[model samples]
Target: MSAELEGYEQDYAVLTAEITGRIGKVPRLVGDEKKLMILNVEKQLDEARELLEQMDLEVREIPVQSRSMYSNRMRSYKQEMSKLDTDFKRSRIAYSDEVRNELLGDDGNSSESQRAHLLDNTERLERSSRRLQAGYQVAVETEQIGQGILENLSQDREKIQRARERLRETDTNLGKSSRVLTGMLRRIIQNRVLVVILGIFIVFTIIMAIYFSIRRH
Candidate 1:
């Protein structure tokens, strides 16, 4: 890894950690303090984005073999950043809802009509909260499904690589067997030819012996 890439990574990590800490504090605070913390986190998130872009440029310049590992790390960092942003947004919304509820509470001095109006607003907030909860649940399920699909695809790629290696091994073994069969066939043909030559020599000798005996007689 280049020194520049390492520097960017370190900066990103620190920025994200700070952002996470600030987001955690947001819910515990209220009014101006909470709003200011939210703003600070948002600013840090933007800085994190810049750092990620710098890291991406560095990764592209690196060698191909090492690029993949860094690229994967970059993706992981982006995902973490996204989750942090989501958590921060959720905290901000929860804080807003908390403030709204406090405002809606009927002080004992509230008239009957005022109390009734507050009750109606409270009901609307509750309905909205329920809808938001339902949507968040669906989003979570969809993310899980997408993760599962990616895992399956990764497994399938490994299976294909293993199958290709096995095929290469099989081809190598077949090549050896073919050479062995060829050698055995050649040897069998040579042996047959030797046997035919020996038979012909024996027949010639027998005919020569018969002709010599008849001439002697």
Candidate 2:
């Protein structure tokens, strides 16, 4: 599961970076408001992607019994992400088509109707381009956010592993302490028994001396 998520994140990052870099290069070609809107969309996409990545991280941390809920939510988020990609591509293609048609129609004609047509197509192209630009920004931000999240998750795994190793070491130390205590207790019992035997022998010797002295008297 971890490997799959990592692979997906890597691919997402690469694709997103390429798309966003491409859009960023075209800032000169787009209006200021369109560019700002695109950047805003990029931020939103980053947040959305961060949200999804956090959930996936939680899935790994949560108990096995409750992972199904997160898994379902992830699936839904994935569907939404896919839809966003589709809409983005579709809008770009549409805008490109409009621009191509407008260019083709601008062949030395100076009629009022031709000017109006150009104006209309130009407006349409701008709108479509803004939409496309926004989507592109969003896609790129998503990948960046995803890559960041994966890195965090990796760090958390390392922490958990280190904690487990410490716990094992503690258990081993406790076992050694227990054996040492047992050996000490065994020696204490043996010393007590030896003391008792020595005391009995001293008492017997004194009693025998008293009995012989009384008989002599």
Q: Estimate each model's TM-score.
A: 0.47, 0.46
Q: What is the C-alpha lDDT profile of model 2 across 30-148, one tens digit per residue?
A: 35754564566466456557655755664555445455565565666555654554444333323343444464575534544665676677667657766775685466447545756
Q: Relative to the unseen true structure, what is the Cα RMSD of model 1? A: 9.5
lDDT of each: 0.76, 0.62
Tell me the tens digit of each residue's lDDT in model 1 across 73-111.
976886686677667766664434455557556453454
The 10 consecutive residues of candidate 1 with the worst lDDT sum are 92-101
Residue pairs clashing, model 1: none
The TM-score obtained by model 1 is: 0.47
Best by lDDT: 1
- Total backbone clashes of candidate 1, pairs 3 or more residues apart or in separate chains: 0
